[model samples]
Target chain A: MNYPIIVDVTLREGIADPEGATIERALPALGFNGISHVRAGKSFRMNIDAEDESSALAIAAALAQRLLSNPVIENATARSAAKG
Target chain B: MTRIGVVVFPGSNCEYDALGAVSALGAEAEFVWHSATHLDGFDGVILPGGFAHGDYLRPGALARFSPVMEAVAEFARAGGAVLGICNGFQVLTEAGLLPGALQKNRGLTFLCQPTTLTVESTASVLTRDAFRGQELVIPINHFSGSYTCDDETWASLVAHDQIVLRYKENPNGSRDDIAGVSNVEGNVVGLMPHPERAMSTLLGSADGRVLLESFVGAPVGAR
Candidate 1:
């Protein structure tokens, strides 16, 4: 079976997001209003050959933890992109 | 003479500078390629600055997997002193030899300038000879140099005197003005400043001598 996975890596809550803050600060000048919060993160999309959805998720979860994100500061979530 | 080994990753640009600095300190210095599996006979190891693995997937991320890192980690565990500067500091954190991680500069710009650093702790191998609260002028050149960590880690670091140096002016907006830190055992030290580049008065400052000399002069029985 084939499963399409997307791994989203985000800085943990309470960690400062300077880049996101800078972008949000710039938004008001560009006529975009009411933007209260903005955060930036990285996403990895890939397909894996697996026995089942759970297996692919497991593999992706491991990769996300080991390579895609630094667990000390970032949290990563791996989920299937395929529709049921 | 103290024999110091400088680890060279494929993209490391400061290995030669580190060699010169160690040699100038009257210590025997040599380059250790990244693929070597063992770090035998060296009294100390240095991870010099540069964009290892082209700083891909974030600085120091890819370089931690190098074969030499395993040996470096082992050397540090065995009590050999290790100093990581700039990108080397990034590698240390990525390799889990040191705490926290380097993030993009607060303004999202690559900063290149002389920075003032204050010696916060003299307990670490790199700062053993330095005096607490003494200030040193060093150079910092990098895009990702902001130091960040969780509140829990920060509290422990404070309790342990692990924060070795701090930026007097907080150039990159690192958390708590942290410019350098050491491992729990104080054998491994990492900092974003380029101390090697500040080795001579002709270079505008010779304050690095205190730090580099401290590394070279560490107790022989410690390693």
Candidate 2:
């Protein structure tokens, strides 16, 4: 079966996020208050042909580790999409 | 004379500059397209500056999968000198030949201009002839030039003397002022500054000659 996968890549905690910081700074002035933290990340959605969801997740995990995210400064997670 | 290959991606803008700079040093320089699968007869390979693959999905992410990278990786393994400048540096990190990643500048600004860099270690093939701590003025132009790495990797890089050039002024807020690094074998090097843009005194600094000359004169198959 083909399973849908979602891969999320984000900067690790303590790593500088200048793009996130810039957006966070803009939020307060635009009347969007009470938001303490704002971090930016990327998400990729794809369908993998595998035996089942678990196998698809494993393939997604490997893809996330090898390509979707750079381990030096970023972390990645893979999950099966809810609808797919 | 050393024959240099300047790898050219579709979006590469500085291949000609790198070609001119290397050729001016009396080394025969030629362009190697990204689709090429072999790097035969080239003693040095330079991934020059530019927005490869239009910097999509993050700089260097798409370009790292190009057919030429396979050849470039093979060349590095055989002890051929590989130099990655600016965006080329990003590709090297993405290709896992280098240890760190280039992030957006600390202030979220695109930086461009000349900067001073100190030669931290001459252990790399690209910097073997450079004097330790010698300063060179080179130009850098990019939005994502700040280098970031985890602590463990940073320690290993230091221990191996792979931390090559450090910015004298930390223009991009790189970790430990690192502007350049090399692999453990010293056959590969990646740096943010554009040595190709600093070849003449009229351009405000000829200090780049020190680094480029070192690469051109390095012994091949040293590993």
Candidate 3:
């Protein structure tokens, strides 16, 4: 079976996110009020060939932990892609 | 004669600089392609700075899996000296040869300037020639040079005396002003500063020679 997966990577909480902070700082100046806690991250979408959806998701999560994110500084999550 | 291998990733721009600097210091330096699987007859290895794999995913993320890294890891395990500078430092952390991570600078700006560093530990191959508390001025050029680690790792690093150099003024908001660190055995080291660029006073400062000399002077597999 072909399982579509989406991986989201983000800086782990408590780590400094300068890019996010910079964007948040600009929001109030651009007349967009009350916007806060902006964080920047990366996303990867791929299809996995596996026997079942659970297996595919497991493979994707393992990939995310090994390559898609640096466990020291980033957190990654893999989920089944929503069908269009 | 000491033979040092400088690993060159596809996007590496500082291999020549490392080669020239080490050669000027009287060591035989050569470039090792990232695809090569072995590092035979090398006393030490230097990973020069550059946007490895074009900094995709992260500065050193992709380059960590290069073929040469396996050999580099094996060499390091056998007590050979390994030094990583700038982007190379990022690779070391990703390869798990060193601790901590290099994140985007605190202000989100690329820093290119001479930074004063205090020698914090002379136990590593890179700093053995320098005295404790000695100051050296080296140039740093990177966008993600700020060093960070979790509290547990920080405590372990402190306990092991692995922290090698510290910035005098906290240039990039690195945790505890750290500029360099070494593995527990002191054979592997990683630093964000470019000591290769400071080989001559004519260019700026010759303080970098103190560090490079220590590296070149060490015996093969000195740990």
lDDT of each: 0.93, 0.91, 0.95
Question: Count of backbone clashes for each model?
Answer: 0, 0, 0
Q: Give one digit per residue, the lDDT tens place, for model 2 in B20-65.
A: 9988988999999999999999989999999999999889998999
Candidate 3 stretches greater than 4 Å from native: none
Work out the TM-score per prediction.
Answer: 0.97, 0.95, 0.98
lDDT of 1 by residue, A1-84 (tens): 989999999988977788888999999899999997799889999999999999999999999999999988899999999988
Instruction: Give residue A34's lDDT in candidate 1 (0 to 100).
Output: 96
Which whole-number lDDT from 0 to 100 does residue B36 have in model 3? 94
Docking class of predicted structure 2 = medium
Candidate 1 off by > 4 Å: B220-223
Ranking by DockQ: 3, 1, 2
- The DockQ scores of all candidates, in the order shown, are 0.78, 0.78, 0.88
Candidate closer to the true structure by lDDT (higher is better), 1 or 3: 3
Evaluate model 2: give its lDDT.
Answer: 0.91
